[model samples]
Target: MKIVSEKLAQDQFTQLKLKNLKTILAESIAQADRGELHNINDVFASLTKDKHEDISNSNI
Candidate 1:
């Protein structure tokens, strides 16, 4: 009984430190829709070339 309680406590602690991805993504998407997300990707894109630049030339 004591061991089970200890394991449960450990699992709860680990879970607390883990991310809730669904909640996080929902919040991020909501913020983006509301224009609250900073969305600085364009700033970084200028530093790199188009990722799909070779897509058109591919033989696939």
Candidate 2:
């Protein structure tokens, strides 16, 4: 009986932690969206730069 209570308490704590983590993640995503993060554009530009460099090297 005591062990069962302990397990339940642990489960509740874990659930609470997960809920907090989810809230934090949601807030982070909202902030990123508000900031208009350009990670994708940056990645595309970097890939294009690399391709250009490759082409230049090949020509040389």
Q: Pick the candidate with the highest lDDT.
A: 2
lDDT for each of the candidates? 0.60, 0.70
For residues 1-60, what per-residue lDDT tens digits would candidate 2 score against the true structure? 999999999999889867866765566567577885546554345446756986999998
Q: Could you tell me the TM-score of candidate 1? A: 0.38
CA-RMSD of model 2: 16.0
- The best candidate by TM-score is 2
Q: What does the lDDT come to for candidate 1?
A: 0.60
lDDT of 1 by residue, 11-31 (tens): 986685344434555666787
